[model samples]
Target: MSGRWWLLPGTLCTAEVFEPLLGALAVSPQQCRSVRLDRPAVEDYAAELASVEDEDIVLGFSLGAILAAHHLDRMRALAAVLIAANPFADTPEKSAARLEQLARISVEGPGAVMAAAWPALVGPDARENPAVGNRIVAMAEQTVQDLPAQTELALRRPGAEPMLASARSRALFITGREDPAAPPDRAMRAAAIGRHELVLVDGAGHFLPLEAPRACAEAIRAFLLGRGQDRS
Candidate 1:
């Protein structure tokens, strides 16, 4: 049975964020589908993804990765790719910071959150690239309407260490060298628990798929092929 690719976007992004990476992978629209995860609660959000097939290759980014990890038991996946994922338990400081960001979003609105998070979301090179920076900002704006709920869900989501540690499906965890949200060290630790291969992309920040689509795609492609699950 041939497996399909399921591209999952982060909290402040839509399926469009995966467009460049999908193109780089030379994936046909019919062979791959983007799953929208705009729901507020983790359970509700995970429920929305019940349509995923047993043979689907789940590739999740950030919050989506968290959700994917949460629901790994239900996915009978061919393989899983986690990009800039925070699969470990959240720290007190991290939880507090997320709550503070939520509060700011509630009062100051999404624009303020975006402004504060922009630096950590992309690499220095992306900040210099007007097109990439603007695109990231625009995508954030588009999904900011759901930021409050998304933030709440992300902050409250459970850790995936136990689940990933026992997962039978081959997994790949990719992190950005400069990602403040999920640094390489933290990601490495998490990947160790799952026994997943970890790849750190140079000069990338939190949004590795968007910041380094070609590199991300290549890693994903090689992973899939290595596992003999080539969708191509």
Candidate 2:
């Protein structure tokens, strides 16, 4: 098991989103450190991420995964585990859609946005659970105190392909089979381009860490252990 790790949570998420997965992985809090999206500029985010030691493991989720993919070369050892990653570039159409989302957040409030996003964020099984949906909404609403600023940080993220290609061997991508936002195919595209491993959890959605913690943890363990074996 790795002794230290640097965790990056997704947009509007605190390190709390990682609690379930970390518990599932049997990693102690002392061995882990996490960062939030306080910085507005992408460069600022990268500058802050540089604090991670070369030997420490990285585990990033969603938007956090996208950031990790761009900054892969910074870490010299222990491949990053990027979960529910969306490595695609931002297109004009996509940006426009996001603008609409931002507009909605302004008019209807963050809770309304979270309501619309909940079903798409989880698979059918998780959607059926009131507790799961409620928690996602609550967490998103709580952590996203600065909703507009947090939303803006992810607006113009550059394509991750070029960045990942240089440090292809230092990353692994994991995604949910049913994830509409970052499906298996998208993760596969990244894995293929980056020349890294890809793991797809069955019946999972964008929130794999919470939806299927055991499966997510198993894949992370296998990647870390198997990668170690490869070096041996």
Candidate 3:
């Protein structure tokens, strides 16, 4: 259990929009931690990330992947779980249309819902790289007044496809390919729940690590070297 890379930011993100996947995962040799959740109400922002531990290698994004699929089973030594352009739930009217789009982006604000979620979070060459779309819309206008009340507490939590339907960890669902917010059919129904792996950067979108941070840090360092993780 020697892996430790965290970096989870999205939804009016910070940590400088994961500064190019933390500088291409700091040329990974392990140990890369850069977390941020400054309020998007999943029980008061994931209860201050309840001391993030348990094997570590989370790497969430977009509403921090619904608070890392609800605190990834109490952070139980997670070896892999890297959802980027996040979104889950196959139906129930798409989780009630994502809770009516988080109550219309918390009453039409978060900079008009991040200027209507920046054309579904850049691509087309990172929206022609105006310094990567003005540094990811200046980190979504510096956390656009707390992302519509933390996206209305993550659209009233509990929908990462039945909380990662029978999750055995070791998952990956990074997306983009013209992501109009969690596109790619919401990462193919969140990679058919559990035991997943589905990347689609090809022309990026939905902030794929601020528009392709070295192809989202080499697809999360090849999913932490296909879950072997030691890398040494």
Candidate 3's residue-wise lDDT over 1-232, tens digit each?
3656666677667756766776776735346676656554556645545655666666777777657776554555464445454554334665576567556766775456655556546778766666765665577667666655665556566566655675546667777778776778666666767646777778877777777788767767677676422121
Which candidate would rank higher by TM-score, 1 or 3? 1
TM-score for candidate 3, please give it: 0.30
Ranking by lDDT: 1, 2, 3
True-structure lDDT of candidate 2: 0.76
Model 3: how far residue 168 lies from native, Å: 12
After superposing candidate 2, which stretches have Cα over 4 Å from the reference?
227-232
lDDT of candidate model 3 versus the reference: 0.64
Q: Which residue runs of candidate 1 sit more than 4 Å off their true CA positions?
A: 45-48, 227-232
For candidate 2, the clash count comes to: 0
In candidate 3, how many Å is residue 142 off? Answer: 2.0
In model 3, the clashing pairs are 40-150, 54-77, 55-77
Worst 10-residue lDDT window, candidate 3: 223-232
- TM-score for model 1? 0.88
Q: Where does candidate 1 have its weakest 10-residue lDDT segment?
A: 223-232
